[model samples]
Target chain A: MTEYAGPLPTPTIDTAPFWEHCRKHELRMQKCLDCGHVRYPASVICPKCYSENSEWASMSGKGTIYSWVVFHQAYGAFFAGIVPYAVAIVELAEGPRMLTNIIACPLDEIDIGMPVEVAFEDITAEFALPKFRPLGKP
Target chain B: MGSLGDKYAIVGVGHTKLGKVPGVSSIGFNVLAIKAALEDAGLTREDVDGVLVKYPTSGFSSLFSGKLCQALGITNKLMAVIDLAGATIGTMVQYAAMAIDAGLATTVVCSYGDNPLTGPPGTYGRVNSDDAAFGFVGAPAGYAMAARRHMKEYGTTSEQLGAIAVAFRKHASMNRNAQMQKPITLEDHQRSRWVVEPFHLLDCCLVSDGGAAVVVTSAERAKTLNKKPVYVMGWGQAHPAWDIAQRESLTVTGAKRSGEMAFKMAGVSPKDIDLAEIYDCFTYTALVTLEDYGFCKKGEGGSFVQNGRIELGGELPCNTAGGLLSESGMPGMLLLVEAVRQLRGECGPRQVNNAEIAIASSQGGILTTHATLILRR
Candidate 1:
């Protein structure tokens, strides 16, 4: 078990849906209605066409290991024991990249373009962090 | 429009001591620098009607801003915090100009402060995200990766990278305020421990705790300032793809877009620049910025920095105060201060002779956001 003590992000009215989906172990992205562009950050207007109309769509929660680093230092007192953990940016198949941590895999084995799938770790009673694990060898 | 060539002077500039002052809080540093800037400009706190603040990790807190305002005895003014990551200093300048142009404020103080090097534990920790696996531990490694890619593509040698460190070290020897004044040699740089492969310990920048502030007023108001006003000729900013993989090309940065816009706005060519204070978080940073800023062609930065082209007294003198590589690193804010100092002819031994035009460029994040400013005497 890991401990987290930093301030938790409050899901405002605009961002509640995204957080709710994470709680349910689902990846959601905002899809623009005007130009059919998918956006990672939930926004009121489409970045491409500036349209206010948008919809939330579920994603496969699959992406490639775009880039990552193993932090030797702990982020906070709560994570002091978890030194030397790997964090990474995953490029979703839908074209949005997410900042996430890679787990259940050896650090040395992580590389660019490695296939990964999202896994939820319920940290607090209300929040579940989205981590990733390597896809099993076929 | 006024001729872009005309000067747009910097009325005031201020810098806090560069080191671990544990007793001083972040807001304390901001107020200290701002007060110095106000006095340097020979104005009262009430004279400042606009304010712009930028913090490293998070945006400014209203409580912090209010504390500084009360300490400085300032009340009732137009203000906004600019949170553009590394380009905060330049963006602050742009916002101040907008305020002046809009008649909302007369004198605007743009300031930045941080104490990461000596603050509470985990002060420099990475943001909570999943991207830590590739050992993207910190800014140094992120820049090291860029250096490695540059080497793989352009045959940029480690020796050439050392030249940047060595040159900046030489420049620091002449700057009393520079944090690291001891001279460094290529041998010393090569022998330094490896923070990340292809980037020796010397290749990384110092993580110092400090703050920097600059004051901008209308051209008319600047005429009465105590010090010579170094004009803000032009400024521009650009955001490349947020993710490193999404970049069109890693070696080339969006600095080109910002540089081109700044140059166009100032109506000056790269050759017109008498001096430059480009951000050098790593050796390759300056190399890539040189190409991106149009000083040299793309893919030519490796060779361009070789043979002391960027050294003091070179055709294009750079980082005359040793930059972040050798001097104190204040998150690229010091680069702007050095540019202002050089244009004002305040730099004694390391000053560029007859330096009438100067340009400064800074990038925040992993080359994701870039900002450039053109200055003139």
Candidate 2:
């Protein structure tokens, strides 16, 4: 197992639920009750309707690549072993985008609009990060 | 609203010798840059009744402006600190103008200084985020994603992106104060190592240690100052989104709105401006801003930068002082200083010919915050 040495998420009140869901290997996002809009990074109030009424909805775990980058250099000591890895922003089918790693695909093969599904990687004893791998691909 | 009515002008501009200075403390650079700007305006510290200081990446104090004012022994009625990241400088100018307009103060001094080279290697401790865990480390990665999207959407090519670095280096070669004075060919940019995909090392701004400051006062008062007044024809700022993932569109920026407001306020269009001092943390930043600021049709930034159009003496010369890429990376305020200097006919070798009106646009965060300013002689 590759040690996840990068920074860990410190769950604030607004973001704790999102991480808690990830620990259970569930892709969850905040959906506004007022405007039926989905938001990310887990905010308290709805960005669309400014309503405080919101609920957590389990995601379909399906999305497409919007954009991506391959790190040629390690930005920190923990990430030194993971040079040349791809970091991508995945646009969920529900219209919210989240940052994740595109796994199970060769670095040279990743392309915009590639379909991917959520896969949980146990980074820490208490937390499992939701990463992505190409759907229906080994 | 009506061309700012000659209401405020940048009376003076000053910059500390940009690049690494071994022992200068962060605040140490601030004091030096502020003193130099005060000297350029031929006024003592006492003449400044308002102060604004851009928060440094390190050693950012909540009372930054107050501390600077205290160091100079000047009592300022309006003192503020802004943390717009790279866009702080341009925003400082906008807010300072507002302060004078509202009678909070008369002469406002906005200053920024930092020693990032002496700070941590990447400028801060590791950023804690889910994205950071995935090696989405810093500005380069975020910008690379944006560039990749631009390429996929608009067919922008690496050659077109490299043209920005080559042109800015050509301009920087003529600027004695520029950090990278050696001119680079397009081949040099193409061959440079990749910091992140779609962005070569040459495409990024320099990580330097230096300071910059500017003095803003009413045009009536500025005309009596020692230096020629560079009038603030108009200014506007917009922050459509803070996070990169949340932005409505990667290809557009808040500049779409901010630039429109600024041009309307300046009573000028992109065609009327003679030059642009755009924020170029990365070459793509300048390219995208040019598009959003109405310099070119959307998605044509790649083509607009081709064939030396952005080089010195080219039509609508940009980043005439080499910008952050080849110039010092004191963030975006230095662009304002360069715009003022260019309007004053002070840049000896890199001066834009007959430069009457100039625009300085800045982007902060991951193409998040934006500010636009129009200046005229």
Candidate 3:
């Protein structure tokens, strides 16, 4: 199999826990203490309530494909081998959306509102990306 | 707003040449545009009391801001660098006006400069984590997705999208400074290759290396300037959703919020707008913005452009200076300069006759951020 090697963002202090959970093969998002709102891309405070009291909670990793596109060109050399991959914005049941690549499925099968479940790919020592596949498929 | 309608004005504007000028440096182009703007305003460097630098794609810090001031030989002045992405240029005008309104500075210069084409390619890195994995790479791909969605949802045709390019090219042919003035036909646009599905090569904007600057000052101070003063009548901004996936609707935009706010502030409705300089990063951007701005109903942008509403002699003469699609894309700063020129009656062949009120709306960061400004003569 081809290896994935490219520059990855170093998780900062505020975002370290989220990356840690990703390493553990689980997707964790921040939930506001005051409003009970779930958010993504971990921030210092809740955007809704401005409350700093928040914690990382494990999500069910189930969502609908909100929108997607099939890329016919390679954006970079690292992904040049993976042309015609589907990138989708999944609206998680927890209320926040995440951008991720859909794998383990045919590109023609991808459709908006298709039910999906999280699948992890251990790409590197420090990172295990959270990709998605159809709910019942391998 | 204040009682000064048609009072506070843009007296001077300067723009660096477009396209790959690898011989020039980033800071060099910035300082050059600043000096040219100051000269255009008929003011010496010493007369500048405040500076607002909008560096969208650069590392703008207090040190850099101070370095620009020192290089321009302007000392003992208040300076700030505003980074608002695509709206950086239009927001500079609003920020300068606020400074004058609050009596913080008498004369202010807002400028942006860069050689996006000639610089080391791919230096900015991937904008998002998923972009690299799925090949949704740059702005073109991001926008191409939106265009596809718009067509899928509203029955918008590719030919209608090409009409925007056609209208802009017609206007660009009249502008000497426009980088891509060569005329193109609808067949030509369709024959062009595809960067993304449903969006051909002509639907994308050309990357150019250029800089543009504008001078904003108090109403009373502008009267004494040599050039015609294009008044800053109103301004507004809005952020619909930072992430495109989470937006309420993909076909619409947050420009409606900003455009409504600007119209209310200016006390003028859409019918009162004589001309417009909309941000056309892609043809769909302008089409969606037009609908969102209340110029046309939602899902009617394709038909609106087909009827020649955005052409030179049409009801609303839009992108008369040949938008970013046809003109040089100076990170959207030129939109403001072109709007000011149209209101001042300086656009020779593309000028809209009896143009009194003008509007310029800029969309930045994949429709994540937007800013609008109203100018009056």
Candidate 4:
């Protein structure tokens, strides 16, 4: 795992479970029990059906790059050394999209619609970030 | 359905010197802008009975419109603190007009101010998402991602985006209050440093320290004010989705619905608008908004902006006061101020000839929220 100095996210009551799953390298998300709808960032109610009944389901950890950008400038000291890194919106196979960093691939090679899979990077002792690497990478 | 159209008019507009005004707090800018707006209307603090402010609200700060009213030493019976981000100003005007129509207050003042440049950078309001943990830093990166998607879907070229900056810079050279007055060609835009991929340094707006305010009153009472009344012909506000990454289409913006509402209410079309004070936080933003607002078909904004179609005296002039690109970046209220000035025939050299009808579209939060207004003489 690469060392990270960026600010860590504080888990909320609704989102703590997702982070807990991430720490174990298991990708999980809330699925609406009433409508079989899936949601990201762990919401209590379904956006499509407004159903309060939900359950956590493990994801396949597969997604496609919907869009990406290369940050040439760093807004903080932690990113100074990582200038020109790629951040992308990856659309998971289950229908929800997430903002994540594309790793293990050259920044110039990242493009929309490229297949990718999640890789766990333990940035801290208590938390591990779910980053994406190009499919088939070792 | 009843409408607030033609019932209210912008009687006065005021702005402080934009770009790097030291020793001014955020609240101080509001007071300065309000006082100037009142003075421009030939009125006093007592004449203002309603107040609306944007920013430092909605988890940003404890300060609200009531506090701003207290700071200005005025007792307003009707006041609100709107937190729609860049759409704050555009939405504020709508609420002010509704307040007037509802007999809530006679005269309303809408204002906003921030010292993002002179004070701490990134102090301006931005969407706080979990994406921040993934190094999604600020508005530039979020907007850049959308621009990239647009390029992929529509084949939008960097040069087409550059044309927007060049047009705004050319207009800014004619205005004294513009931060960047020197003309920049497409080459100049291409040669500038990249802030993020697909966005050059010139493509971004100036981080400015300033404030702007406008007075809204009934058209019946505006005849007694000091300036010519710019009637609010039509206005609308919309939020497609708050989350930028989850929008159905990256290129489509809230202006799609908001602009439609405004035009339908005004009984006008895109061809009827003589000038467009559309938000230009970035060059691509203007292009996308132009398409979403029906200025052109979708994916044709790149071509619609080329060949000086948006320059002064073109088929449709945009950013007449250089907009946020060349003027101050105090959000979209400045666009309202410039639109009113153009309709009143006050803009000296950068004025669009016989600009009787104008449209100003303001967006906030990575194109999440939008407000459109059609103002006429």
**Candidate number with greatest DockQ:** 2
Would you list the C-alpha lDDT of every candidate in the order shown?
Answer: 0.77, 0.86, 0.80, 0.88
Best by lDDT: 4
Model 4 scores a C-alpha lDDT of: 0.88
User: In candidate 1, what are the lDDT values of residues A10-71, reduced to their tens digit?
Assistant: 66677778878887878888999888898866778887899998889888888887666555
In model 2, what is the error at residue B190, expressed in angstroms? 1.1
Better of 3 and 4 by lDDT: 4
> What DockQ does each candidate score versus the true complex, computed on alpha carbons?
0.14, 0.74, 0.34, 0.62
Docking class of 3: acceptable
- B168 Cα displacement, candidate 3 (Å): 1.3
> Where in model 3 is the C-alpha error above 4 Å?
A1-3, A7-9, A32-35, A49-55, A104-109, B1-5, B56-62, B120-136, B246-249
Q: Write the residue-wise lDDT of candidate 4 on B122-168 in tens digits.
A: 54444244676787876688788889999999999999999999999
Clashing residue pairs for model 4: none
Interface Cα root-mean-square deviation for all models: 5.5, 1.4, 3.2, 2.3
Order of models, best DockQ first: 2, 4, 3, 1
lDDT per residue, candidate 3, B173-195, as tens digits?
Answer: 99898999998998999999766
Candidate 4's DockQ:
0.62
TM-score of chain B of each: 0.94, 0.97, 0.94, 0.96
- Provide candidate 1's TM-score on chain A: 0.89
User: Which scores higher on DockQ, 1 or 3?
Assistant: 3
